[model samples]
Target: MLDAGLPVRAFFTDRRGGHSAAPYDTLNVALHVDDDPDAVAHNRVVVSEAAGALVTFLEADHGITVARIDEPTPRPPKADVLLTTTPGIALAAIAADCVPLLLNDPQTGAVAAVHSGREGLYRGVVDSAIAAMLDLRPSGAGAAGIRAAIGPAICGACYEVPENLRARVGRRHPVAVASTSWGTPSLDIPRAIETRLTELGVGPVLRHRHCTFEDTRWFSHRRDARTGRHAGVIVCEGPVGVSVPAPEDAAT
Candidate 1:
């Protein structure tokens, strides 16, 4: 787990640590990937156990909707952004090649996990999330004090897209406009995301350089269709107590 540099605890999950088998091999936290439901449950338990907090993971639809988690629940909502100020609960966003963003405001101790895919980014997921985050803060709060982490995802060189699609996204996000290694039009999502964060006044942004499509340690749907998904999780310290067997016990 790489440190997110936020005031709260944060980390990005990879493919090496769960009970899933084959393409979803291990550490697949997503419930809709057609993996064994039992295995997914075990995986979620393991993740929550390790954090000593209740886990609330978003079921992303690649849209800009938001879900507010005041406490841990049996079912997390379907949204692109999950936010909570409650302590002792974790907020997570699952993804394979799409970007999983962990955001936190140290001053307010409010944290959020966001799913920023190409469509969501094009449709303003980042802006929506930041707006919601600010709403949770004081009257004058902005994103200047928010700490953010960008997890592994398909790189620009590997995310080839049609010209019109690139143009559509580029018209708003010029930094997203990119060319693949072989010279086809592509979208450098991570880079574009970092640029957006910088533009938003968020500082000291932490970004992982791993490309999901190029790194076997990370599950990549573009590289291996029907593959599993990993997640970006943020656990805040609070009063709730939740526990279960550790991941090692379930992964085997």
Candidate 2:
């Protein structure tokens, strides 16, 4: 877990250590997948227990929907990102090959979990999330204090695209257009996101080095079309928060 001085703890879970079978394998956190519902629930329970809090799960639909910490419980909203300031309210987003972006305002104790895939990128979902966080921040202090982390996903070397899709993504962030090992044109989704973050002046961006497509440990939607989903979770923590457990701690 990365501590951003916010009133929460956040971490991205790769595809490992859960109770699902076959293509879903072990650690599939997505309940929407055809995987056993009981297994998904149990996986969430395990994550919540590890965090020492009750986790509030969301069904992500790759749109811009913001949920407040104190709202009447309704069906999961179709949002690519979820934000909250309430302590212990875990804001989560699911992805297989798409990028999961986590943001935390060290001063305001507000956090956001964003699912930015090709469509979400095209729609400027990440920019919207940053703007929303700025709006939620306390007076005077702006988005400068916000720290962000972009977790594992398919890298440009493994992400191929046609010229049209390339042009579309490049229109937003030109750095995405580059060559790959296969001698084909590819889009570096992470680079595009980093460019956007730079444009937004978001502080201290952490990019994970792992690629889901290359690493068998993670669930990749493109690599396994019918595979289960992995989750990136963020939960508000108490003033005296507990330490985040290491990967080995939860390997069992």
lDDT of each: 0.82, 0.73
Best by TM-score: 1
Give me the candidate number with maximum lDDT: 1
Query: In candidate 1, what are the lDDT values of residues 1-252, reduced to their tens digit?
Result: 445555568888888778999878888888888999999888888777766687888888788898889989768778999988888779888899999999877666778899999998988888888888788666975577666789999999999999999999999899999999999999988888888887886755778888999999999999899988888889866322222223332210
Roughly what TM-score does model 2 have, to 2 decimal places?
0.87
Q: What's the residue-level lDDT of 45 in candidate 2?
A: 77
Which segments of model 1 are wrong by more than 4 Å? 238-252
RMSD of 1: 7.4
User: Ten-residue segment with the worst summed lDDT in candidate 1?
Assistant: 243-252
Candidate 1, residue 246: CA error in Å? 36
lDDT of 1 at 34: 95
Per-residue lDDT tens digits of candidate 2, residues 1-252? 223223357787766778999899887888777999999888877777765666666666666666554432324567777777777677667788898888877555677788888888878888888987888655654566466778778999998888788888888778888767798878888878877886786765667757889987788988889998777777754223222323332210
